[model samples]
Target: MKPASKSLWKKSVSGRVMVSILVSATLLGTTAACATKSGTDDAAVGVTDDVIRLGLLSDLTGPFKAPAEQQNLGIQLYWDQKNADGGACGRQVELVTRDHGYDPQRAIALAGELNDSVLAYQISVGSPTSMAIRAELEENEIMAIAMSWSPDLGESPSLVVPGTYFGAEMVDALDYLIEEGRVAAGDKVGHIYFQGDFGEPALEGLTYAGEQNDIAVEAVQIDPSITDLTAQVAELRKKGVSAIFLNAAPPQLASVAGLSEAQGLDVPIVASMGGYAPQLLDTNIAATLEERVLVVGSVTAYGADEPAAVAVRDLYAKSGSKVPPSQMVVLGYAISAVMDAAMEKACADSELSRDSLWKVFHGDFQIDTQGATVPLDYSTPGVSPSSQVIVLRPDKSVPGGLEVVEKDYAGPTVAKFLDR
Candidate 1:
């Protein structure tokens, strides 16, 4: 195997050199490999010459607080590590964070605030929040990386960026179940969701995939205001569902899993990209939730068995935040990894402006390049609608970690079955 070159990148102020000779599409590319240990800064904006100003929006004080706070720990840790390393392209990257409380209006305000303060944005929670701030984000031309799995998120803006999204992820989960023979093509798959746009897309994807692959689909919807899903479970069981798909958060997911287990339903229960986590596992409904729940992910969980994941472990240890890493935390690291790559590429060329970073994001990314994880394939146009995903199963042996049972699986990703 070819060893990576020294980290001491050469710096210059001359015209940009197209470092194409060392390029490898499957590798980090010339940007990360040949980037000079140097960068530009808008001192007026408080951006230090050796610092890349970055921002993060999360639900630290809101309903999504548990997941978003976990992401904050990871994001802060990422910047800490980057600053320690002299940051991407020879400069340090400073990360700024905010709490949106899962409200779109507040998210818009937060986006504007970050726009005035930094170069880029990273999000850790909420569709409503994203929907609120998207316009302002585009107006500022800031590069955004997020953990939202919404399909519409893939739609690119002059400034907005879509992170890992949902529909395609469901395809990954469904495909895994199929390939593993956990369910057959002719079986009836159950869908249980709270009525909302967030849950609607998965249903759309499930129905679409079923039509293409030949499977039966059944759906059940429960009121989000309700405390339990015993009625929903009974309805699904009456339909004789051979497999189950969920598009709810932890509390709801736990409730459904508990009810299913209580009713002695043996069908495989799969969750959308952000369903089950350590929190959901140990809830009042923990017993049943631990038995048969799988979560599909648009990004790797923090406990990933990958190179970047190792970096995250180091961050987690240093932060002293005891919460187990979830899609939110892991995506925090992953987005940082992408930003590092983009900043390295842009700063090497002495173009560290928000617009410049946007260009780099469009050019330098290689998420799951070799299919190691879910590849963020920007080569295709829309992001959210096309993002791939992986399957995560709870594992007792990994202490505060999840075991990914499948990789780049596309069967569960389909949404047609849910539509039926």
Candidate 2:
């Protein structure tokens, strides 16, 4: 496969380089037949008489390592149970994991190495890394469920996004603040964000919603490498904004929250799901987070009464894991359930080829995660699978150190944003 075009990558918006993919008769033709054959003469590459292999691209040693490791555990937990229960389509599930350490170039190389050997990538961890490898997956006609979400990924049918993108999440979060009377029309809202894929989309959402609500949006773009957010928080404080929105990593969040409290910014702070971690509750800023920060995400929180949440919790206990609870684990298990359903569809069709599996998502196949998230459908290109979001606040007593403030929220701004 060709290396992603450097010129295109340079021009890509907010680090999101997208392929203008058109999935049609030609895409589903001989390209799929060219896949490596195995198992009863019709199985695709990565499928054997006794195993079906899926790839894992994660950031095990980088900034997001904590949550990434938990997600990997969740992925493994799902397969372990499936393999124990006689597996999917009568074959045990196998994972081919590669740790990219949050590096984009490393992710591209790792994805190339696994392109021809796995049925699909079960998880691709970070926004930048996922963006980096997307073109290669399209070139190889492989499918992947990217844990990162960007508007760019929506354009490709080959990459499945489990829920709405960061933009939608941010939009709903702002609306949640408005509905809860934290902010109102004509108020000024401050936003602190990273410079690339993850933060840009969220900033866009906040800007759009601000316009609709007649609120002035004050945005500060920060480099991810910067851990001290005292200046940013002080700047926003000087602006006298009513609320603050954040899109960044956990450490950055710690800095912002701590500094905001020390400076008496005294405003409600909301963060994108990426901006938090369960471990943050053990830090000096723990009380501040619980008192002020709200996190927006699509999946149910850990220890929720939802059935899938309970199942994953049981699995974690059975495995004797010392890792603290995380919502990423539930997401890992949910995406695996989606992958299993697609493969099962292909098996029932009597043609377990790459094309058959890919077609399931493009057809009427719907993914239900039993309350892990809203039901998902991937048939429409450039569209989010679900707009529903769950808002949570930090609570040390909670199993995940977070509890839901609102569930299944689809505020008008977000609903309209997704509609467009």
TM-score of 2: 0.89
Worst 10-residue lDDT window, candidate 2: 25-34
- Give the TM-score comparing model 1 with the true structure, all chains together: 0.83
Instruction: Give me the runs in candidate 2 sitting further than 4 Å from their true place.
Output: 1-39
Candidate 1 — worst ten consecutive residues by lDDT sum? 1-10
Structural similarity to truth (TM-score) of each candidate: 0.83, 0.89
lDDT of 1 by residue, 1-420 (tens): 011122211111122233211112212222243254344444324255555567777787776777777767766676676566555655666777788777778878877777787877755366667767766766566667655656555453422333345555555566777777877777778888767666777776677666666877787776667658888788788888878998887667777787888898877888875566676555565555555778776556556666556556766777777777665666666556555655666656655676456555444244442222466544333444234566677765464457676665555434333233
Q: Which is the leading candidate under TM-score?
A: 2
* Candidate 2: clashing pairs of residues: none
For each candidate in the order shown, give its overall lDDT on alpha carbons. Answer: 0.61, 0.78
